[model samples]
Target: SPFPVHINRQQVVHISGECCHCLRLNNLGIFRIHCHGQRGLIEAKIFNLSVGNHYDIGQKISFQLLESYEQLRQFPLEIFRTSLTILLTAQLRLVQERIRDLIVEEKSGCAIVSFQLFEIAAQLPKNEQVINILRNLIDKQAINLIDPNRRILHAICGSLVIGPKGESIDVKLFSQANGDYIGEFTPKKIGQYRIDVTCANIPIQDSPFFTEVYDPLQVHIGPLPKNILIGIENTLEINLDNAGNVPLEVIITSPSGINVPIKIDDILTMKKVHFTPTETGIHYLNVKFGSDIVPGTPIQMMVNNAHIISAYGDGIHHAVHEKEATFMIETKDMQGDLQVDIEGANSVIKTTIDRINNSLLKVTYIPVEVGFINISIKWNEKDIMNSPFTAIVTNPGNIY
Candidate 1:
C-alpha cells in the first residue's frame, strides 16, 4: 500500500487514498487516522489496519482517508472515537462546572435572620471540545480557565435568588483577599430554597441546588444560673419544641481562660447541659444552637470561694470519760458532708452528728478513757474553721 500521509501528531491524519491491502505502524505511541475525501466519490475507507495485542484505543476506530481533490454532499463521520460514551453523556458541548467549586462558609442555621456565604471559584469547562483543544496544544501547562467575572451575582444573570415565598433576596458578592468571589444572602422564610447560580445566562453545574432553611431560634432555653459553687455539677435545660434540626454547642471558659468540657443530652424540647466547675473563680458560659448563639450566652458565673464554716459549743471545752460531750456547727449555708474526728484517745471514742437544720449540726462524742482529746471538725474532708480543738477529759469519778 502507498499513500501520501500528513499527520498532526495525535488525533488527526490527512491522507489520500490510492489503494490499501494493509496499513501497519510499529514501535510508536498513540496515533489516529482522520479521513478527508470527496464524499460519494467512492468512499476512501481503510479496509484492514493490523492491530497488536496492546494498541492505542485509536486503532479500534475507523479513520477516513482524507484526499484534497474531493467534495461530498454529506459526511456523517465528523468526529469519531471508540470511548465517545463520555463525550455524548451530558452532551459534548463545553459546560461551566462551578457548582462543585461552590464553597459555603455559613454563620448559622437559617434562623429568623440568617446569613450564609458561598465562595465562587474559577469555573471549569468540560466537554469533548475542551478535550480536543487540550490534546493538540504545545504548552500543556498554558491552559487557562475563564473567570466568572461575578456573573453569579449579576442581576441579569439569574443571581437574583428567589425565596420560598417568591421573595427576591439580594445577594451581595465580594472578592476575598485570595481572589475568590463570595456571595452572601439571607433566607427570607423557613422552607426549602433553590439556589440556581448562572454564568452568561447558563446555569452552572449542579444548578437548582436545594437546601432546607430552618429557624434555629424557635427553640427556647431556660435561664442560666449566674452563680454556682465550685466542685458542683449543674444541669441546664433547653426546650427544643422546634429546634431539633440543628446541633447545640456549649463551651465554658474557666477564670484562667481555659475551655471546660460540658455534657449534652438529647432534644425533647428538652436538652440538658451539664458542666462541673473545678476552679474557684468567675467562669464564662456560652451556648449555641447551630452556629447561632442563644439569647443567654457569654454569661458570667461567680463561684464563691469555699463557704465560711463557723464552729462553737461547750463540747469543745471539756469531756468526761464514758460521757458524751456536745458541740454545734454553723455551716453558713454551705453544703457538704459534715464530719467530726476525735484523736488522742486511748480507746475508741464514739462520735455522732445530728443535722439540726440546713446550716447547723450537733456533734456529740463519748470518750472511753480520760485524757486530753483532740477534736477535728471537717467538711468534705477539709478541716473547717478553727479545727483540731483540744478538750480536757477526766474520769467519771474525778469529774465529781
Candidate 2:
C-alpha cells in the first residue's frame, strides 16, 4: 500500500527497504519510485538488495508533493510542481522591501541611511552575513553607483558637494556599530546637496537623497553712518542679522585708538549693538561669530572734530544805536577761520571779530539805527555755537 506524505520544499526524505525470500536468494531487485500528487511516476531509483540485506536512499525533492484534493484532481502534478517551485524560488529570493529614514545635514555633511534586508517571504536569517555584505557594498560602491565620475569630479561618497569653482570635494565616511550606515563630509560651499546609497549591488528605493547646505552663522551688518559729531556723546547703532543661534564677539576701536564700549541685545534673529565714541576720528569695528568673520567686517566710521562750548556778549540782549556793542565767545579747541556779521531793519551794522585765543573769540558791532539786530557767526564756513544771535536795538535815550 502507498501512503501520502507531505513535506516542505527542499526537505530530504530517506527510504530503506530489505527483502526476505522463502528460498535462499543471492540478490533481490528493488525499485524506489517518486510521484507528485496523483501523477504517474516522475522519478525512480533502482537498486539490488541481497538476502537479509537492507538498502537505504536519501533524496532532496521539491514540487513533488500534494497539498489539496482539488489541486490533485485538477492539474495534479502541474499544480504541485508549480506550488513547490514558487516556494523554493521565494526562499532563495533576496529583497530589500523598505528603506527608512535617510537623512543628511548639509552644513555638517553628515548622512545616515537605514534599511533592512530579508528574503522575499519576509523571513530573516539568524545570521546577518547578508546585511554585512550589503553594508560593505553601500560603503564601497554607493557613491560610485550614483556618480560614476566621482574620482574626476571629486564627489564625496553618499553626498554631493561641489567646490566654489565646481571642483571635487573630499568626503569622510563614518563607521557605525549599529546596522545603519552613516557617511559624513564637510561641504566647502553653500547650496543644495544630494546623497546616493547602494546596497548589495542594488540601489535602494529613492536612492538619491537631497539636502541644502547653509552657513551655520549668517551675518549682515547694517550700513554705517557717514558722519559722526565730535566732543559730544555720539551713539553709533548697528543692527546685526544673525541666522544661526551663536554667540558673537564684537569689538570697536575709536579713531583715537581707544576701545569703545559696546552693548548688545538680542531679539529673535535681529541683534542690536550700541557704540558710543568719545574721540573724533576714523573708527573701526570688527565682528565675529564663533571665529567666522562677518561679511562687510572692519567697518569704518568717520568722526568730525568740531563743536561749540559757549557764547555770550553784551550785545546779545540790547544794542545802542550808533554805539558799539561788544560780545565774547568761548569754544572748545576751535579751529579754522571765523567771521561775524550784524544786520538790522533798514540799517547796516559794521561788525569786527577778534580771536582772543584758540578757545575764545571777541566780536564788536556798531548799529546805525535803533531796531532789532541779528548777529551771525561762522567757524570754518560752518555755524558756531549759538550762532545767529538776536539783539533788541533801541535809541540811547530810550534806554532808562
- Measured by TM-score, the strongest candidate is 1
lDDT of 2: 0.46
User: Model 1, range 1-400, lDDT digits (tens) per residue?
Assistant: 7998998644221221111111111111111112232111111111111121121111111111111112211222222111122232233233322111221111121101111111222433422233344333312322222112211110121222221213343444443354333444544444333443433222333443444444556757665643355666666677766443455677889999988778888745588888888888788877776546777577787765444676888879787777878989988666566677787656557788888988888888887777888888776666666787888888867655
Off by over 4 Å in 2: 1-173, 176-218, 255-257, 267-270, 306-400
Q: What is candidate 2's lDDT per residue for 1-400, written digit by digit as tens?
A: 5998998774222211221111111212121211122211111211121111211221111111112223233334444334433332343343323222222111212222222222223345412444444334334543222112222111233322111112233433333343333343444444433333333212233433343333434566664543355654444444433233345678888866778887877666566777667787678888875435667778887666655445686877788777888888776664446667778878667877788877787878888877688887766545666777789887858767
Candidates' C-alpha lDDT: 0.47, 0.46
- Candidate 2 local Cα displacement, residue 364, angstroms: 18
Worst 10 residues of 1 by lDDT: 19-28
In candidate 2, the residue pairs with backbone N, CA or C atoms under 3 Å apart (3 or more residues apart, or in different chains) clash, namely none
> Cα lDDT for residue 310, model 2?
55
| CA lDDT, candidate 1, residue 392 | 86
Clashing pairs in 1: 35-64, 36-66, 36-67, 38-71, 240-269
